[model samples]
Target: DQIFSSALTAALMVGLAALLCGAVLYPVVVHLSADNEQKAREVLDSHISMMEALGRAIAKRDSDTGAHNYRVAWIAAGIAEKMGIEGNTMQALIAGSFLHDVGKIGIPDAILLKPGKLDDTEMAIMRTHVDQGKDIVIGAGWLDGAQDVVAGHHEKWNGSGYPARLQGEAIALSARIFAVADVFDALCSKRPYKEPMSFEASMAILEKDTGSHFDPGVMAVFKPMARAIYDQLADCDEEATRKLLQDRVKHHFEQ
Candidate 1:
């Protein structure tokens, strides 16, 4: 009876000690977790700011108003959401859309800003922007997720694209989705080379290229949403578009 009592008492003492230790450490652990989460948020915000700065630099170099980046990012994110793409994939699509033309920074102004169609040689040189963009984003760890759209946006659905000529599902989904958004925006937006085409004309072109220049699946999802998206963004100025895109970035990345 004496031995049993001692063993029972020892077990109770050990249990009490463990409970005390947990009580003492729980608050510290909770504090550390909260601190870590805040630091992570700060790091993410800094990275996003850096991405915006690089996008602005590319726009300045290309003589663009930078509205294209904001518009495309907004449009792509919308389409992605409709297609049920969420989480990190959606975030990558947004980032890639903003930086898709970043490689134009490396192109000569003669080619990038030419008022007329590029000749064969100039076109060849211009296409190198895709590779240049890939190299630029590949070096940054935070920007790594963007490499897919950067490297593969120019690729077509039928294997007629540049650089790699990737076909069908072989191309990154983000790139495919961005291609649809990019072409739609370019057609509807005014440029030095030509006046903006009407929404009808733009959709017509996108429809015609369904399986040739664009992914059929992505186009199908975007077709219904195109008119609303264009109408909403068409009249908005750069500031408005920027604010809209910032809200989207926050939704996908910070929230």
Candidate 2:
């Protein structure tokens, strides 16, 4: 009887201990989950902040009206997402979109922020950002996946764009899509060199570029989303722009 009772007591104690452990650990598990989510948000937020800082740097360098890069990046990401990109590829697109001009950081100020058309020599120096950007991000070990964006965003479809001049299907899709968004935003937004173009005029320009300057298929993907894209462009802010930029660079080349 004693032995049986002792065995039973041990079993009961084990069960009680397990129950206590579960009860105690449940809240800890919940806390950890919450903490993990918060951390993820912070990480995302940090990336956005970094993107914004970069944009501001560009604006400072060029005496920009401010927030154009942010807004353009927002529009670019919208177009990309609407086209069905997701996951890391989407993120890379976002990051690359913001950093596409990062190479400008290396361009001579005379060419980079020039309010007038660049002379051939200046243009030559200006285009080096593509390679310069590639080198910059490639050297930055912490910015994983940024190298492709830094290097390839300048590539154009039909092999007309600068730097590598990679031909169709060879150009990074993000760059192809970005070429449209970036140029469109520039056309529509006020700049030091020229007054902003009317929305109608901008559309006409994009339409004119069609197959030559922009990707025909991506342009089609963008056409239906114009209104949504416009809404997003209007809604953008520095904070939002930063987020869009990060997602763009992160997603661009993967899909």
Candidate 3:
């Protein structure tokens, strides 16, 4: 009887110890998990900040406000959202739109900042920005989605574009959407080369080039929202535009 009682006691003690250890470890596990999540968020935030800084640097280098990218991103996201584009696709569109000009960073100021039309040689160099931008984006693991826009934004619908000359559907969808947003913003924003066009006139230009310069399908979705998006960003300063774009990016990527 004594031997049996000792064995029973030993088993009960072992079981109790295990239960107590688990109870103690549960909170620790939860705390560690929370810490890891926070660290991940911090890392992601850092990466995004770096990208934004690089994009804005390009904008400043070209003597344009970073607002150009902000407006383009907003327009792209709006069109994408209306088309029910969600998940990684939408995130890529937003990110790629902002970094689309990253390749221009490689161009010399003499060629990039020229006020007049680029000669054939200069134009050739300028065209290489697309490939350069693609290479830059491809090097960064976090910027994988930006490759399409960075590589193909200058491509035309009729196969008359630069770098690759990819025609029609051969071009990436993100780049197609970006082309529309880019031209829209460029026309609406005043530049040293020309005055800003009215929304109607801008639409006319976009409509005229449908199926030639832009993807007809993407243009169809963007037509309705074009005026509204332009109006919203028309008066926004650079800081406000950046804040708006950052919020939209965070909503899509962080969630």
Estimate the TM-score of every prediction: 0.92, 0.79, 0.89
What are the per-residue Cα lDDT tens digits for candidate 2 across 1-255? 999999999999999999999999999999999999888767766766676577567667766624766676667778877888767766666666666777677777777767777888888888787887677666553354556556766666677777778878787777777778887788877655678777778888888888887889988988777756665565566667666555655445322
Model 1 residue runs over 4 Å out of place are 1-8
Query: lDDT per residue, candidate 1, 44-150, as tens digits?
Result: 99989988999999988875649899999999999999999988898888988899988888999888888888999999999999999999998688788899999
| Number of clashes found in candidate 2 | 23
Model 3 lDDT per residue over 141-241, tens place: 77888898889889999999978889999999888989999999999999888999999999999999999999999999999888789888888888898
lDDT of 1 at 250: 90
lDDT against the true structure, each candidate = 0.92, 0.71, 0.88
Clashing pairs in 1: none
For candidate 1, the 10 contiguous residues with the lowest summed lDDT are 59-68
Please identify model 2 stretches exceeding 4 Å from their true place.
Answer: 1-19, 139-142, 227-255
Which of candidates 2 and 3 is the stronger one according to lDDT?
3
Deviation from native of the Cα of residue 21 in model 2, angstroms: 2.9
